[model samples]
Target: MLPESHASPDRKRRPFLLLVLVLVALLGVGGYVAFQLGGDDRAPVANEPAPETDQPSTEAYQPWFAGYTDLTATPVFTFETPDSESGRDVVLSFIVAATTDACTPTWGTYYTLDEAVEGLDLDRRLARAEQLGGQVIVSFGGLLNDELSTGCTDPARLVAAYDEVIDRYGVSTIDLDIEGGNLRDTVAGERRAAAMATLQENRTAAGTDLAVWLTLPVSPAGMTEDGATAVSQMLEAGVDLAGVNLMTMDYGASRADGDSMAEASIAALQSSHRQLGMLYRLAGIELTAATLWTKIGATPMIGQNDVAGEIFSLADAAQFNAFAQENRIGRMSVWSLNRDQTCGSDYVDLTRVSNSCSGVDQGDQRFSDVLAQGFDSRPTSAAPIKTTEEAGQIGDLTDDPATSPYPIWTEGSTYLADTQVVWHRNVYQAKWWTLGDLPDAPVLNEWETPWTLIGPVD
Candidate 1:
């Protein structure tokens, strides 16, 4: 989402009393008893064991707090504020291609990496946030501007651009918010998938984790065709995708007349879960329902969405958070931390979208407070735990016609769309007319081959 032109107003600090009430509401009576027994009113320490509850522990819940911070918003966001009431983990967003050089990354196409370090005081603030046990996940791409992969056609240059940002930021997790033309361009999608696959491989070989998440626009029905293709390209290129985070806002005509914002978001998430399950299966990996839930995330525009009549309120935030915790979604994020607070009386139009303040009534309630209710973990903690040895192992089993469910694929044969064949002990379906392209080709891009892997032989 693009920022509005209005200047930022004075910051309002959350009251300490509100924090205590939030803690009590989240921790229940058992926690209050423990607090009284301890004879101290200090907030619980980070990573401390939570008091016993009938529901699942915070550890079991996969909802980690990474509220998006519009780095280039007006008046700037003080993410490193020591006593800030917002959650510790912040998602510094929209690291897009530089206006001059597509291969060079810039923040919202406004400041170069070094320039941001100086002008935004980014490096020092980031260091201070880390000192306070806070981590940041850099998000690339947004509603506007060109994402690096779309602008940099050369695969090597694209990979280098991604590497530069990852290396510079020292971030293990990155979110690719593909939308608009970037999402629909099949060629760019292929290029991105290949580059990400290479980047992940390099990081894996170096004994470092590079968790990648695809943030795409979605509706209550589920991910659009282009959105699904974007994800398919990533998986087909061998990128161990961390998760699929749906932009659960701006439904427009997609939302039913009677549905609340929370209801619509939940429906979108539920549909996305099913869609992702099928996508994973097509990539020859089948995940359990619970495991697949962890591979999904939801992000709603906090308040006053670009689409008229769409406002995600505080009540909606609470309901959505409850659903996320219940299903153990991998991550939770809002449109921006910059807009978490309510607008002042100066704002003449509440309907007009603002970057500095949320155009809604927030009575001692920050969107971050409600959205990040039980998400106590960091973004890095969401990375899939795997050893280098396990990652290095590759299966080389052959397909046998006796055990296969379909006829063995042959290079000489031209296959039509929907034609299923067996290759290397896996089932694949042809997406279009093809000949000589290997179903098991060691191609980086999905468009390089005609076959789509359906699953391993059962």
Candidate 2:
């Protein structure tokens, strides 16, 4: 999740006394709490406590599950570590531009796709994981190297490069972890969007589909301006985005001093929900709060973050997991599977971020065990990719009031939140007070309107 340069042996330690004070506050508050980072000069960040809601009786909430694996890290991950949970999906990262050819893709800068199959035995390991009921989601881009679009100048070759990786891996879902310079390059963003749209369309025409997820960096304030633009570009290009995965770590100065990593993450997700809703509406789509949650995903940097004094401990994992389950978020992921375990005794400094070991004291726990607690579903189970023509069928249907269970929606009538109405033979509920917004509008994005499609009236 972080480049090599971001790691340093020198970092300010969180004072033990301050930590104890924060723990005492948490005990008294009896809900989600935020703690100040000791030695941090930034102002203390404060986040509202998580709203209280009745906890679900059963562990039935199942979001798609995957944990990132750094493909080029030392002590190579074989997908069979003893700490790994059975049937857990792994997101192999990253497929970046080859040093020799910008259009050629490699697993980080280390191994070509075919070379990895032979050298790393990647193909066999993937098969073994699949045999055990696990799936793979190939992640492209990263903090270090050039993502395909950033370096590849030609449009045709960019699309081909992505296609080659997808074809080689035989994966349906792909994550684009656009960050750093890649996120800011508007031209690259457009090129990436266009290339993905073309690739998706070509695949659909050939009787297959691609589920693309934009993995962008975020702060407690929500998505950065460039990130929102990247998403907007994707929507404008007619790409049916699977979801937006937030990199909920390394907040830097954006995180207030006292805010716990989990609290900051929750605040980021909530803010992003509102921002994404507005973006979808601008694109003429309306999605329900529930549906929007499914279109959002969170990936926390487990154990220690790149920024000094920001540690995401096991307790934070439990709190974040509960929030994800309560909100029914679509996906849950960690920054890496490589750093899931505790550091060995030889490693002296626990504050320094490491590529191989988590800078924490894990008595006998794995980050995946806590983060992937209730997320039992596979990543491939995400909503299917729908073509524009397929999505257009909603507008062609007519609603008959005689058979509709709810009142037929009228443009002149004001509807309050939770008001249900019939449109195009389907039930829709208003997310908030609105008048004149069509429930059955021919919109491409779900967040474009104020109505949420419940289901077809039987």
lDDT of each: 0.71, 0.71
Give the local distance difference test score of model 2.
Answer: 0.71
Residue-level lDDT tens digits of model 2 in 258-282: 9999988887787677666655655
Give per-residue CA lDDT, model 1, range 1-458, as digits (tens): 44332332111000122223433453341000000001123221111111121222344344587878778877677888733545588888779998898989999888999999888889999999888888889988876678898889888888988998999989999988887777767788889999999999998889998989988877776677667778788888988888888878877776899999998888777666656665665566755545566678878887787677878899999999988877677788877788888889898798877878889999888888888877776777766443121111233456788888999988689889989988766678888998876775532224445777665576
How many collisions per candidate? Answer: 0, 16
Off by over 4 Å in 2: 3-62, 80-82, 383-458
So what's the TM-score on candidate 2? 0.73
Could you tell me which 10 consecutive residues in candidate 1 have the lowest summed lDDT?
29-38
